[model samples]
Target: MSTTGHHAAHKVVVIGGGYAGTLAANRLRTRPDIGVTLVNPRPEFVDRIRLHQFAAGTGQATADYGTLLGDGVRLVVDSAERIDTAARTVRLASGRALGYDYVVYAVGSTCAIPASVPGAAEFAVPIAELEPARRLRARLRELPPDAPITVVGGGLTGVETAAELAGQGRGVTLVCGHTLAPSLSAPGRRSLATWLSRHGVVVLEAAAVNEVRPDAVVFADGVVRASALTIWAAGFGVPRLAAASGLRTDALGRLLTDETLTSVDDDHVVAAGDAAAPSGRPLRMSCYAAGPLGARAADTVLSRIAGTAPAVIDLAFTGSCVSLGRRAGLRQFARKDDTATNVYFDGRMGAMYKELTCKVALWKIRREARRPGSMIWIKGGPRPGQPVADGARDDHGARDARC
Candidate 1:
């Protein structure tokens, strides 16, 4: 909440404290000339990828920000309400206003709850955020073992949640609107389905849920099943704060930026993570992508101040590491364009790989906080104005999951 000196003093404000926001602030605070202030609602850093484990009653979803943020950066525990680009001021929920020379709009997404599906919002338990996931875990513990728990959606989040709940000896059923993991290779999908069946999880493909009732879920075909506890892992949607602020954003409410991750309307602003629609093609909202995007956003600001050319945002997905549960998982290896290759690792080895990835995500942030500019994210050295071939953007993971 402190900004000293005059107008010439460089200052940057990063809204949101998710992986992208955290990394951007940590990286930018390293520069002695610029001051960085991070705005977030929570005091802790929530590991969004492991939120399923939190809902399953097996893992912790938060880390201490003291260990992940740089010493020079100021942490503001407040939510952003609006951005006045003309004034270079950010309005906070606490009725305070802060001016910035540059701003990073990283206010991450929220649960994508379907409105067409009646009762889904009232009956289904959503675990996308920390507080809701904690409540879901608490609610699951209150139910008996024989209580039928319905998990809607077939994406990575739904699959991981179903496995974790089933491993805890709960009666679980997965209702995928379509085939499971459409983003994965056919072999990869087979492996996941087989493992789910082995654990006694009922997999219902193409069984779209039309409604969620108090004690049961009604399918599109009018069939009803007992669902004492319903967990919704459908999809995620970004908040409309950006659009409400009059910034250029897509239909999904993600801020529109170019290949540089810089705002098309204002050079004083940059964006990253799930909240950014770069060239109208946003990357998959994962911590993996967030890490590099955050790095690129910070680098953009530094290069602006230094009067040097900033690098373009060029990234490729190598593979996807998914955790089925605490015991088993799948690692679907892919090419630069994110098409699933024949290579993969499964079973305990796969689980171990996913675990290491989550750990590495945190480790990278801490390392960057201690040794700023130490992060070594892979970059495609595409010449300026050249269209870099980004990874395959097609995803069939979660069409039903959202806030």
Candidate 2:
């Protein structure tokens, strides 16, 4: 690949159009020295964290990447088939080749559906992507008015889905393999359970799903009769793009990256979002981490292009929010070090807070798209302190004061 009449410097290519890749591309557009191109299969960036909301009959879930991208950034709507790190070039699915001086792999993650579960492949719907979520929502609406709905996996997605379905006057049963929100504190989990029960969701904790059928789910204890609508939100698995490209990856196929989110043993490649595993640390797959990691990855790329060592990437969580339908939610606070903090908000107010958080996440991305590097203000605060940071604290205080 030759630049021809173009500039004769370094070229950067970023894979994926999700939160991480979009942010990284926008940030890179700020620099005039480097030529940047973003390669993704989709023309639009889907709000993945809100996929459940879309499935549960909420707002639209897709955003135009063209609107989000900056003027100088080139958009390549194609999948990366192969990456020759030694040759410093990438082969796309469209048979075109792109040579890059630096590459950022933010392809995101996919749902790992177990093959052992019968009928799961045919019937179970995974809300990991926008299209699937939209299809699931359409199927759910077509079901009988009073049909029984079963949601497998008691994690955040399952709980939220169950709550939303139940809120729509459908009988929902949330089957938890072990516990609901295992990352949450004990009190937070209990509050989640209570809220689900209150929302008419029959939560069965510690009930492992042995198999899924078209009209029923077989658990370890017994079988739960259900309708045609079965949702699977068990776990996340990264795509094999990294492994296929001959890069270093984990057992789950996530590209192993150093502290600065650069690919190990390959400084020319970097990764962010769910497709990246930071060396020596376990970070949960959430949009919270994706947004920050995206920015950090961009910073690293820019620093390296500027002939400087990239800064070390560090992510600290503030809190986690789970919405139980549109009426109730739980906000779990965490310490500055990302440890669980004994603070939470429940009931209607909590639901409002959760909605606000979703809006803010999308807003932050859109704001950055409109004005690159504007989200650096978020780093000034003390790791965002979860639900107790400024507005959240005041809201909690006001609720407590009223109580």
Candidate 3:
């Protein structure tokens, strides 16, 4: 907070340092009159899209904040405990409070091993966030070379995790619960399915995990499969900070905001990333949407400070890509509203698309750090108050966000 001095005309505190939060903090620096302080639990920036690669010992998942955050943006290595909207203060985990003229609620998403499943809470390893991914990486290292590994969920993350392990010559079984890659078209799913089968991995589409034990996985139909290591890549969950702070949220605990990404309760509190439910129909939870939402949130605050009406959200989705392994992948083409189309890229071409997307996502964040407000996204998504078409809703229960 010291980077901008204590007496700046306006003060903004950004919660969470994910792609959205980091970009929002940097974008706010466009106005020197506005002082920005970012509050995050970790000191380094995490490339969440690479968490699966990290868990499989294929790639690193963190980047130095110095290389990502913009100048004059103070970084606070503390988690936000609560947001007292009435008092305009944010309570931190370290027993300190930060006052702000406005707050960006970009606290990102996470994955949890369900306690309802007997022993899953104890034996399963989740690879969606930093700590869980770290644990999975360490656990993989500790296991023998031929250990039986099971990946739950058939979404993009599940598909990627199973493939990465299988490519490394591990015995991997993917419990799809239902259909595999539900977001992809029939042909695209077939392409990915073919790649997985050819890599010596077992695909179980109808098997829903009923319970997880230290030595095996019990299916819903009472069949038992031996699994030495169970990697959980199931559904996602957002932090309860917004709900605990008494903000209006959708059913999934995403902050309920207007089309401009401003909170319904108060204009001083804006939201972005996976945590934001703009107009109650949130976009997919991916780095793709996070970057633009971050910039939009900053624009909303700047508009208020300048006494102008903020523009509504106008962002579109191209598609989602997932790596089959380091060598193969799939890119499912999507409509402007994010529904899957029949067109897609597969094999070596798909792998190139996946790698390029990852590199470009990071490059966009770094570009924003160097040039505030220079970030841009494709327009023509569903309008405010417009209903998202069938299959355009967030993929719950199975898939993590698309690539």
User: Candidate 1 vs candidate 2: which has greater TM-score?
Assistant: 1
Winner of 1 and 3 under lDDT = 3
Residue-level lDDT of model 3, residues 58-135, one tens digit each, is 999999888898888899999998999999999999999999999999998888677778988899988888899999
Runs in model 1 lying further than 4 Å from the true structure = 1-8, 381-403
Best by lDDT: 3
Ranking of models by TM-score: 3, 1, 2
Per-candidate RMSD, Å: 3.1, 6.3, 1.7
Task: Write model 1 residue lDDT over 288-324, tens digit each, in one string.
Answer: 7788889999999998888898887877667787787
Error of 1 at 210 (Å): 0.6
Query: Local error of candidate 2 at 96, Å?
Result: 1.5
lDDT of 2 by residue, 67-137 (tens): 67776678888999988899999999999999999998998887767788887878899877777888898
Number of clashes in every candidate structure?
Answer: 10, 0, 0
Clashing pairs in 3: none
Against the true structure, candidate 3 has what lDDT?
A: 0.86
Best first by lDDT, ranked: 3, 1, 2
Give lDDT: candidate 2, residue 32: 64
Q: What local distance difference test score does each model get?
A: 0.81, 0.74, 0.86
